[model samples]
Target: MILKYIVERNNKYKTIREVLKNEFKISSRLLTKLRSNKKVLLNGFSTYFDKEINFNDIVEVYLNYEEDNSNIVPNNIPLDIIYEDESFIVINKPAGIAIHPSCLHYDNSLSNGVKYYFDKIGLKKKIRPVNRLDKDTSGLVIFAKNEYIQECLVRQMNSALFYKEYMAIVNGILEQKSGVIDVSIARKENSIIERCVSNDGENAVTLYEVLKSFDNLSLLKCILKTGRTHQIRVHCKFIGHPIIGDTLYGTKSDIISRQALHAYKVKFIHPLYNNTVEFCAPLPDDFRKIIENEI
Candidate 1:
C-alpha cells in the first residue's frame, strides 16, 4: 500500500522526514526501514528524506513488501472472511483452531491458513493478527496487511473507541442485571496459562449485561474495558459464576463441548479510511443450541 501525502500550503512539514514522521505518524523503526529500502517516493521518484518538500509536493510511502513467513507452514484451510480491504482482513475464527502456529497447533493454526490464502493471491505481506482470542473462543479476528495498519489498530486497543463485545454463558444467573468487574489479574504461580484475581497483577475491567436466562444459565453480553488474558473467564470466576464449560477457569459442562464464549462483535476506526467500522459474528451453533435450551 502506498501512503500518499500532498504537501499543503503553509504546511509545517519542512522535509520528507517531517512529513513521514509528523504527518503520517510513521514510527522511527519503520521510517528507518523505508529509508534503507529506498521506499519513499518524492513526486513519483525514489527520494531520500533529506530532500526538501514544497507545497503540492506528493510524497508516497510504499508499505507492500514480501516477507519471510516460512516458520508457519501453509494449510489449505478455508477462512471465514468477514471483511477485507487494502489495509486489513477480518476473519471469523471458529473454536478449536488457534490464531497462530505453535508446537501443539503447528500446521492447523489460523495463520497457516492465512498464509496459504496469501500465497494464492500473491500477497507476500506478513500475517499479523491484530487482536487475540483463546483457542476455544470463536469470534472476529483481524489481520493487518502491513506494519502501518498494525501500529494504528494496536494503539487503539484497550481504548474506548476500539470496542469489543463477547457473548458468554455462565453457570448461574447473577443477582444484578448489569455491573462492572474492575480488578487486577495475575498469572497463577507454577502455571503457564492460568490467571487469577490479585491486587498485585495488571488492571483489568469487564462490563457485563444479562442478555437472557434459562435453566440455571445466564447468557451475558460482556464488553471489555481492558483486554487481559482470559479476562472474562477469570472475572466471572472471581464473581463465583464462571463461564460454563470453561475447563481451565471453571467447570466443564455437557451442554457445550468448549467454553461458552464467543467474540460477538468488534468496532474500531479504520486506519486507512479514518472512519469507524464495526464487525459482528453470529452466535455459533453450540451457543445457539444452549440458548434455545436444546442441551
Candidate 2:
C-alpha cells in the first residue's frame, strides 16, 4: 500500500520513505518497496526517491496490489445474538474480541463471527457494523446486513440519533453525582494509539452519572454527546478519576483485568421496520464481581 503526505511547513522536509519510517514507524524495507512500485507521489506528480517537497502540496499515492477480501473466510465463532431482523443484527459482543480485522488482529474478529453466522444462513454479502467497540471492551453492537440499511443507520449515527450508554468503574469517588465533561481531544505524537486534551483538538462532550460509590471505586453511567476515540477514558483521566484497570491512560488495578468499561445499552430506529429498537447487555462477570465485592 502507498502512503501520501502533503508538506504543511516550509522547514527542511523529509523524503517519502523517511516520512513513512519516522511518522508511521513503518519498516524501512516496506517503504523502499512502496517507492519502487511507484506508489508514492508528491504534489500529484510522480517522482523518484530524491524529490523536494514544498508547503501546501497535494500528494497522491497508488497501491500496487489490491486488498484480497476474498481470503477473509468465515470462522465458526460463537456469538451472543441479542436481536436480529431482516435489516440488521445486534450482538452482545464478549470482551477480548476485536470488532474488525486490523494489524494486531487479522482474523478471529467479531466481523468474522458475524460473517460466519450469515454464511450459515446462506447469505452471500457481508454485514457492516454501524459502530465499533474496542477489543477489550464488550457490549451491544449493531450490524447492517445490506447497503440500504447501512446508509440509513449511518445517517442516524452522523445525526446522533442512535443512543449508546456505557458503564465504567473509575478509580476515585466522584464528588459530582452527575455532570458533563466537555473537553477537546487530539492525537498525541501523530499516533492513532494515543490522544490528549489539546487546544486545537476536536470538540467532545460526555455526560456521566454516578451509579454507585465505594471507598476506592465508583461506577458511572456514561453517555456520549459526541463520539471520539478514547473520549470517555480520556475525559475521566482528565478529571483525576481514571477508569480502573485502564493500563494505557491510568494506573492498572488487580481487581479488574482490562479497562472497566462496557457498552451497556444502545437504542436506535430500525430502518426497515421503521420502529425504535433497543438492546442491553448485562455487565461482564469480572465487572459484576468487582461491584459485588467493592460496591
Candidate 3:
C-alpha cells in the first residue's frame, strides 16, 4: 500500500523525516526502512529521508513487504465476515472462540480461520487484529490488512478516536437511567485471570444507558471511553450490577454459560478512506433468546 502526503504551505516541517515522523506519524523503525532501502518518492522522483521538503511537496511511501504468517496455522473454521474492504476486515466472532492463538488453544482461533479464508481467496497479507474480544465474549473484531494500517488504527485507539458500543444484560436494574463509571482497574495481586478496581491501576471509563428493565435483569447500551481488561464487567460489579452469567465478577446464570456481554457495534474514521465507518453485529442466538424468553 502507498501512503501519500502533501506538504501544506503553513507546515513547519523542514525535512522529509520530520514530515514522515510528525505529519504521517510513521514509526522510527519504518523511518529506518525508508532511509535504507524502502521506496520513498518526492515530487514523483525517488528521494532520501534527509531531502528538504518544500510547500506543496508530494510524498509517497511504498510499503510492499510480505508478512510472515508461519506462526498462525490456517484452519477451515467457519467465519462470519461482517465487513471487508481493501484495508481491513470486520468479523462477527462467535462466543467461546479465542481471537488469537495461545498456549492452550493452537489452531481453533479466529486468526486461524482468517488465515484460511485469506489463503482460499489468494490474499497474501498477514492477519493483524486491531482489536480483540475475550474468548467467551462475542462481537465484531477488526483486522488490518497490513502493518501500516494496523499502526494507524493503533494510534487512533490510543487517542480514543474509536467508538465501540456493547450490549450487556446485567443482574439487576440501575437506579439511574444513564450514567458514567470512572474508575481505575488493576490485576489482582495473586491472580492473573482476575481484575479489580484499584487506585494503582490504569484509568478506565464506561458510559452506560439502561435500555430495558426487568424484575431481575436489565439490558444496557455501554460505550467504552477507555478499553481495559474486564473493564465493563469489573465496573458493573463495582456498581453492584454485575453482568448475567459472568461467574468471575458476578453470579452465574441459568440462561447462559458465559458472560452476557457482546461488542455489538464499532465506529471509526478509516485511515485509508478518510471517512467515518460503522459496523454492527446482530445479536447471537443465545443473547437474543435470553431477551426474548426471559426479559
Taken over the whole model, the C-alpha lDDT of each candidate is: 0.91, 0.79, 0.89
TM-score of 1: 0.97
Best of the two (2, 3) by lDDT: 3
- Residues 1-295, candidate 2, lDDT per residue (tens digit)? 2345667876445665555545434455545655666666777666775565568765555543322335455778999988887678889888899888776566899888887887788666555898888888889888876544566687777778888899999998888999999989999876868889987999999999999997688999999888889999999999999999899899878887899999999888876556888899989898998888843
1 or 2, which is superior by TM-score?
Answer: 1
TM-score of every candidate: 0.97, 0.75, 0.93
**Residue-wise C-alpha lDDT for candidate 3, range 139-251, written one tens digit per residue:** 99999987778889988887778999999999887899899999999998999899999999999999999988876789999999999999999999999999999999988
Model 1 stretches astray by more than 4 angstroms: none
Of 1 and 3, the candidate ranking higher by TM-score: 1
lDDT of 1 by residue, 71-182 (tens): 7788999999999999989999999999989897689889999999998998887889999999999999999988899888998984677999999999987999999999
lDDT, residue 83, model 1: 95
Lowest lDDT block of 10, candidate 1: 64-73
State how far residue 40 of model 3 sits from its true place (Å). 2.0
